[model samples]
Target: MGEPLATKHDVFQAIADPTRRKLLKLLAEEEMPVTVISGHFPMSRTAVSKHLRILSEAGLVRERRVGRENRFRLDPQPLQEIKQWYAYFERFWENKMAALQYLVESDEPVKPEQ
Candidate 1:
Protein backbone atom coordinates (compact mmCIF):
# COMPACT_ATOMS: atom_id res chain seq x y z
CA MET A 1 0.00 0.00 0.00
CA GLY A 2 2.76 2.37 0.96
CA GLU A 3 6.08 3.03 -0.74
CA PRO A 4 9.17 1.15 0.33
CA LEU A 5 11.15 2.62 3.18
CA ALA A 6 14.25 4.56 2.22
CA THR A 7 17.60 3.34 3.48
CA LYS A 8 20.22 5.60 5.05
CA HIS A 9 22.53 4.59 2.23
CA ASP A 10 21.06 2.96 -0.85
CA VAL A 11 23.24 0.81 -3.08
CA PHE A 12 23.10 3.48 -5.79
CA GLN A 13 24.32 6.20 -3.46
CA ALA A 14 26.90 3.96 -1.80
CA ILE A 15 28.47 3.04 -5.13
CA ALA A 16 28.13 6.49 -6.67
CA ASP A 17 31.62 7.53 -5.58
CA PRO A 18 34.65 6.18 -7.50
CA THR A 19 36.41 5.66 -4.17
CA ARG A 20 33.58 3.55 -2.83
CA ARG A 21 33.44 1.49 -6.01
CA LYS A 22 37.14 0.77 -5.70
CA LEU A 23 36.62 -0.13 -2.08
CA LEU A 24 33.99 -2.67 -3.07
CA LYS A 25 36.33 -4.19 -5.65
CA LEU A 26 39.11 -4.42 -3.14
CA LEU A 27 36.90 -5.97 -0.51
CA ALA A 28 35.59 -8.46 -3.06
CA GLU A 29 38.94 -10.21 -3.02
CA GLU A 30 38.96 -10.73 0.76
CA GLU A 31 38.15 -9.17 4.08
CA MET A 32 40.75 -6.65 5.20
CA PRO A 33 41.22 -4.28 8.10
CA VAL A 34 41.14 -0.49 7.65
CA THR A 35 44.94 -0.40 7.74
CA VAL A 36 45.22 -2.84 4.83
CA ILE A 37 42.42 -1.20 2.88
CA SER A 38 43.88 2.25 3.40
CA GLY A 39 47.18 1.06 1.90
CA HIS A 40 45.52 0.66 -1.51
CA PHE A 41 44.31 4.24 -1.78
CA PRO A 42 46.16 7.53 -1.43
CA MET A 43 43.52 8.83 0.98
CA SER A 44 43.58 8.66 4.74
CA ARG A 45 42.30 5.68 6.70
CA THR A 46 39.42 7.82 8.01
CA ALA A 47 38.35 8.55 4.45
CA VAL A 48 38.48 4.87 3.57
CA SER A 49 36.55 4.07 6.71
CA LYS A 50 33.90 6.62 5.77
CA HIS A 51 33.45 4.95 2.41
CA LEU A 52 33.26 1.56 4.09
CA ARG A 53 30.59 2.85 6.43
CA ILE A 54 28.50 3.96 3.47
CA LEU A 55 28.88 0.58 1.80
CA SER A 56 28.02 -1.16 5.04
CA GLU A 57 24.91 0.99 5.43
CA ALA A 58 23.88 -0.02 1.93
CA GLY A 59 24.29 -3.70 2.80
CA LEU A 60 26.96 -3.93 0.11
CA VAL A 61 29.73 -4.67 2.57
CA ARG A 62 30.02 -6.53 5.83
CA GLU A 63 32.17 -5.48 8.75
CA ARG A 64 33.45 -7.77 11.45
CA ARG A 65 35.79 -7.38 14.35
CA VAL A 66 38.97 -9.41 14.33
CA GLY A 67 40.86 -8.73 17.55
CA ARG A 68 41.00 -4.94 17.84
CA GLU A 69 40.72 -4.48 14.08
CA ASN A 70 37.55 -3.92 12.07
CA ARG A 71 37.68 -5.99 8.92
CA PHE A 72 35.48 -5.32 5.91
CA ARG A 73 34.34 -7.67 3.14
CA LEU A 74 32.08 -7.47 0.12
CA ASP A 75 28.48 -8.54 0.47
CA PRO A 76 27.29 -8.72 -3.11
CA GLN A 77 23.66 -9.40 -2.32
CA PRO A 78 22.80 -5.71 -2.47
CA LEU A 79 24.18 -5.50 -5.99
CA GLN A 80 21.19 -7.46 -7.18
CA GLU A 81 19.21 -4.22 -6.97
CA ILE A 82 21.63 -2.54 -9.36
CA LYS A 83 21.63 -5.56 -11.67
CA GLN A 84 17.87 -5.61 -11.88
CA TRP A 85 17.70 -1.89 -12.56
CA TYR A 86 20.22 -2.13 -15.37
CA ALA A 87 18.61 -5.26 -16.84
CA TYR A 88 15.62 -3.18 -17.97
CA PHE A 89 17.92 -0.88 -19.92
CA GLU A 90 19.78 -3.90 -21.33
CA ARG A 91 16.54 -5.13 -22.87
CA PHE A 92 15.91 -1.69 -24.33
CA TRP A 93 19.39 -1.59 -25.89
CA GLU A 94 19.02 -5.14 -27.16
CA ASN A 95 15.83 -4.19 -28.95
CA LYS A 96 17.51 -1.12 -30.47
CA MET A 97 20.50 -3.22 -31.61
CA ALA A 98 18.19 -5.84 -33.11
CA ALA A 99 16.33 -3.14 -35.00
CA LEU A 100 19.59 -1.68 -36.30
CA GLN A 101 20.73 -5.13 -37.37
CA TYR A 102 17.49 -5.64 -39.29
CA LEU A 103 17.84 -2.24 -40.96
CA VAL A 104 21.45 -3.00 -41.92
CA GLU A 105 20.48 -6.36 -43.36
CA SER A 106 17.56 -4.86 -45.29
CA ASP A 107 17.68 -2.53 -48.29
CA GLU A 108 17.09 0.53 -46.12
CA PRO A 109 20.15 2.57 -45.13
CA VAL A 110 20.74 4.46 -41.93
CA LYS A 111 21.22 8.09 -42.78
CA PRO A 112 23.97 10.05 -41.03
CA GLU A 113 22.78 12.35 -38.22
CA GLN A 114 23.33 16.05 -38.80
Candidate 2:
Protein backbone atom coordinates (compact mmCIF):
# COMPACT_ATOMS: atom_id res chain seq x y z
CA MET A 1 0.00 0.00 0.00
CA GLY A 2 1.00 3.63 -0.49
CA GLU A 3 2.49 5.55 2.43
CA PRO A 4 -0.28 8.14 2.82
CA LEU A 5 -3.06 5.56 2.59
CA ALA A 6 -1.34 3.32 5.11
CA THR A 7 -0.87 6.23 7.50
CA LYS A 8 -4.55 7.17 7.23
CA HIS A 9 -5.60 3.62 8.05
CA ASP A 10 -3.27 3.61 11.03
CA VAL A 11 -4.71 6.80 12.46
CA PHE A 12 -8.29 5.60 12.04
CA GLN A 13 -7.52 2.29 13.69
CA ALA A 14 -5.65 3.94 16.53
CA ILE A 15 -8.53 6.28 17.40
CA ALA A 16 -11.35 3.75 17.05
CA ASP A 17 -11.26 2.45 20.62
CA PRO A 18 -11.75 4.40 23.85
CA THR A 19 -9.56 1.94 25.70
CA ARG A 20 -6.77 2.40 23.24
CA ARG A 21 -7.13 6.16 23.48
CA LYS A 22 -6.78 5.94 27.25
CA LEU A 23 -3.74 3.75 26.83
CA LEU A 24 -2.25 6.29 24.44
CA LYS A 25 -2.80 9.04 27.02
CA LEU A 26 -1.05 6.96 29.64
CA LEU A 27 1.85 6.23 27.35
CA ALA A 28 2.05 9.90 26.45
CA GLU A 29 2.93 10.57 30.07
CA GLU A 30 5.76 7.99 30.04
CA GLU A 31 6.56 4.44 29.00
CA MET A 32 5.26 1.89 31.45
CA PRO A 33 5.10 -1.86 31.84
CA VAL A 34 1.92 -3.77 31.05
CA THR A 35 1.34 -4.57 34.71
CA VAL A 36 1.59 -0.96 35.73
CA ILE A 37 -0.81 0.15 33.02
CA SER A 38 -3.28 -2.61 33.82
CA GLY A 39 -3.43 -1.43 37.41
CA HIS A 40 -5.22 1.72 36.28
CA PHE A 41 -8.06 -0.14 34.55
CA PRO A 42 -10.47 -2.85 35.66
CA MET A 43 -9.96 -5.01 32.59
CA SER A 44 -7.93 -8.17 32.53
CA ARG A 45 -4.27 -8.02 31.62
CA THR A 46 -4.93 -10.02 28.48
CA ALA A 47 -7.50 -7.48 27.32
CA VAL A 48 -5.04 -4.66 27.93
CA SER A 49 -2.46 -6.61 25.96
CA LYS A 50 -4.88 -6.94 23.07
CA HIS A 51 -5.46 -3.19 23.08
CA LEU A 52 -1.72 -2.67 23.10
CA ARG A 53 -1.32 -5.09 20.20
CA ILE A 54 -3.85 -3.23 18.09
CA LEU A 55 -2.17 0.07 18.96
CA SER A 56 1.21 -1.39 18.06
CA GLU A 57 -0.10 -2.61 14.70
CA ALA A 58 -1.55 0.84 14.06
CA GLY A 59 1.92 2.37 14.69
CA LEU A 60 0.60 4.43 17.62
CA VAL A 61 2.62 2.62 20.24
CA ARG A 62 5.88 0.70 20.47
CA GLU A 63 6.72 -2.06 22.90
CA ARG A 64 9.99 -3.41 24.18
CA ARG A 65 10.76 -6.48 26.20
CA VAL A 66 12.43 -5.49 29.42
CA GLY A 67 13.42 -8.64 31.28
CA ARG A 68 10.10 -10.35 32.10
CA GLU A 69 7.90 -7.36 31.37
CA ASN A 70 6.79 -5.56 28.24
CA ARG A 71 7.12 -1.79 28.21
CA PHE A 72 4.91 0.36 25.96
CA ARG A 73 5.56 3.91 24.77
CA LEU A 74 3.62 6.35 22.63
CA ASP A 75 4.72 6.78 19.00
CA PRO A 76 3.31 10.26 18.39
CA GLN A 77 4.70 10.88 14.89
CA PRO A 78 1.72 9.16 13.29
CA LEU A 79 -0.54 11.61 15.14
CA GLN A 80 1.31 14.52 13.52
CA GLU A 81 -0.12 13.49 10.16
CA ILE A 82 -3.60 13.50 11.68
CA LYS A 83 -2.96 16.94 13.15
CA GLN A 84 -1.79 18.28 9.78
CA TRP A 85 -5.00 17.02 8.17
CA TYR A 86 -7.13 18.77 10.81
CA ALA A 87 -5.23 22.06 10.33
CA TYR A 88 -6.73 22.48 6.86
CA PHE A 89 -10.24 22.37 8.29
CA GLU A 90 -9.21 24.65 11.13
CA ARG A 91 -8.10 27.29 8.64
CA PHE A 92 -11.33 26.88 6.71
CA TRP A 93 -13.36 27.49 9.88
CA GLU A 94 -11.26 30.53 10.74
CA ASN A 95 -11.91 32.07 7.34
CA LYS A 96 -15.63 31.35 7.64
CA MET A 97 -15.72 33.01 11.08
CA ALA A 98 -13.95 36.10 9.72
CA ALA A 99 -16.50 36.40 6.91
CA LEU A 100 -19.37 36.01 9.35
CA GLN A 101 -17.97 38.72 11.61
CA TYR A 102 -17.55 41.12 8.68
CA LEU A 103 -21.09 40.45 7.46
CA VAL A 104 -22.64 41.01 10.91
CA GLU A 105 -20.70 44.22 11.52
CA SER A 106 -21.43 45.62 8.05
CA ASP A 107 -25.15 44.82 8.30
CA GLU A 108 -25.68 46.57 11.66
CA PRO A 109 -26.85 50.20 11.50
CA VAL A 110 -26.11 52.67 14.27
CA LYS A 111 -29.12 53.40 16.46
CA PRO A 112 -30.08 57.13 16.68
CA GLU A 113 -32.85 56.66 19.34
CA GLN A 114 -32.20 58.50 22.63
Candidate 3:
Protein backbone atom coordinates (compact mmCIF):
# COMPACT_ATOMS: atom_id res chain seq x y z
CA MET A 1 0.00 0.00 0.00
CA GLY A 2 1.09 3.56 -0.53
CA GLU A 3 2.22 5.65 2.41
CA PRO A 4 -0.39 7.61 4.34
CA LEU A 5 -1.07 11.16 3.31
CA ALA A 6 0.78 13.93 5.14
CA THR A 7 -0.64 17.29 6.21
CA LYS A 8 0.84 20.38 4.56
CA HIS A 9 0.64 22.28 7.83
CA ASP A 10 0.06 21.65 11.51
CA VAL A 11 -3.02 23.38 12.96
CA PHE A 12 -1.22 24.21 16.20
CA GLN A 13 1.64 25.89 14.41
CA ALA A 14 -0.71 27.65 12.05
CA ILE A 15 -2.58 29.30 14.91
CA ALA A 16 0.50 30.08 17.00
CA ASP A 17 0.80 33.54 15.49
CA PRO A 18 -1.38 36.34 16.87
CA THR A 19 -1.94 37.72 13.37
CA ARG A 20 -3.20 34.37 12.14
CA ARG A 21 -5.50 34.04 15.15
CA LYS A 22 -7.01 37.45 14.36
CA LEU A 23 -7.50 36.35 10.78
CA LEU A 24 -9.39 33.28 11.94
CA LYS A 25 -11.64 35.39 14.17
CA LEU A 26 -12.35 37.82 11.36
CA LEU A 27 -13.19 35.07 8.92
CA ALA A 28 -15.42 33.47 11.52
CA GLU A 29 -17.79 36.39 11.17
CA GLU A 30 -18.31 36.12 7.43
CA GLU A 31 -16.66 35.06 4.22
CA MET A 32 -14.80 37.91 2.60
CA PRO A 33 -12.33 38.53 -0.15
CA VAL A 34 -8.70 39.08 0.80
CA THR A 35 -8.99 42.81 0.19
CA VAL A 36 -11.85 43.17 2.63
CA ILE A 37 -10.12 40.96 5.14
CA SER A 38 -6.91 42.92 4.86
CA GLY A 39 -8.77 46.13 5.61
CA HIS A 40 -9.43 44.96 9.16
CA PHE A 41 -5.72 44.45 9.80
CA PRO A 42 -2.92 46.97 10.21
CA MET A 43 -0.47 45.06 8.02
CA SER A 44 -0.15 44.89 4.26
CA ARG A 45 -2.58 42.76 2.27
CA THR A 46 0.25 40.46 1.27
CA ALA A 47 1.07 39.79 4.92
CA VAL A 48 -2.57 39.08 5.65
CA SER A 49 -2.77 36.77 2.67
CA LYS A 50 0.28 34.90 3.89
CA HIS A 51 -1.46 34.31 7.24
CA LEU A 52 -4.61 33.21 5.45
CA ARG A 53 -2.58 30.80 3.32
CA ILE A 54 -1.15 29.16 6.44
CA LEU A 55 -4.65 28.86 7.86
CA SER A 56 -5.89 27.33 4.62
CA GLU A 57 -3.10 24.76 4.64
CA ALA A 58 -4.06 23.78 8.17
CA GLY A 59 -7.73 23.32 7.14
CA LEU A 60 -8.90 26.02 9.52
CA VAL A 61 -9.86 28.34 6.72
CA ARG A 62 -11.58 27.57 3.43
CA GLU A 63 -10.94 29.59 0.32
CA ARG A 64 -12.81 29.76 -2.93
CA ARG A 65 -12.51 31.86 -6.02
CA VAL A 66 -15.44 34.18 -6.49
CA GLY A 67 -15.37 36.35 -9.53
CA ARG A 68 -11.97 37.99 -9.65
CA GLU A 69 -11.13 37.46 -5.98
CA ASN A 70 -10.61 34.72 -3.45
CA ARG A 71 -13.02 34.58 -0.55
CA PHE A 72 -12.06 33.05 2.76
CA ARG A 73 -14.14 31.75 5.65
CA LEU A 74 -13.51 29.99 8.88
CA ASP A 75 -13.92 26.22 9.04
CA PRO A 76 -13.84 25.61 12.78
CA GLN A 77 -13.80 21.81 12.55
CA PRO A 78 -10.01 21.76 12.78
CA LEU A 79 -10.17 23.71 16.04
CA GLN A 80 -11.69 20.65 17.68
CA GLU A 81 -8.16 19.34 17.98
CA ILE A 82 -7.24 22.37 20.06
CA LYS A 83 -10.41 22.06 22.12
CA GLN A 84 -9.80 18.38 22.78
CA TRP A 85 -6.24 19.11 23.80
CA TYR A 86 -7.42 21.74 26.28
CA ALA A 87 -10.14 19.41 27.55
CA TYR A 88 -7.49 16.97 28.83
CA PHE A 89 -5.97 19.70 30.97
CA GLU A 90 -9.43 20.94 31.98
CA ARG A 91 -9.98 17.75 33.98
CA PHE A 92 -6.85 18.46 35.99
CA TRP A 93 -8.00 22.02 36.67
CA GLU A 94 -11.41 20.80 37.76
CA ASN A 95 -9.81 18.35 40.17
CA LYS A 96 -7.64 21.10 41.62
CA MET A 97 -10.62 23.42 41.97
CA ALA A 98 -12.61 20.72 43.74
CA ALA A 99 -9.75 20.12 46.20
CA LEU A 100 -9.46 23.83 46.81
CA GLN A 101 -13.18 24.10 47.47
CA TYR A 102 -13.00 21.25 49.97
CA LEU A 103 -10.17 22.96 51.82
CA VAL A 104 -12.06 26.26 51.87
CA GLU A 105 -15.35 24.75 53.08
CA SER A 106 -13.98 22.19 55.53
CA ASP A 107 -14.84 22.52 59.22
CA GLU A 108 -11.32 21.60 60.40
CA PRO A 109 -9.64 24.26 62.50
CA VAL A 110 -7.03 26.33 60.72
CA LYS A 111 -3.54 25.46 61.94
CA PRO A 112 -0.27 27.02 60.96
CA GLU A 113 2.74 24.70 61.03
CA GLN A 114 6.28 25.47 60.00
Tens-place lDDT digits, model 2, residues 12-109: 76787898899999999999999999998889999999888878877788889999989999988678778888999988767865755433345566
Model 1, CA-based lDDT: 0.84
Better of 2 and 3 by lDDT: 3
- Which portions of model 1 show Cα errors greater than 4 Å? 1-6, 102-114
Tens-digit lDDT track of model 1 for 1-114: 442233478888888999999999999999999999999999999988898888888888888998999999988887888999999998976787676543444567755533
Which lDDT tens digits does candidate 3 get at residues 34-109? 9999999999999999988888888888899989999999988878889999999989867865755434346876
lDDT of 3 at 100: 58
TM-score of each: 0.81, 0.75, 0.79
Residue pairs with colliding backbones in model 1 are none
Candidate number with the higher TM-score (2 or 3): 3
lDDT score of model 3? Answer: 0.85
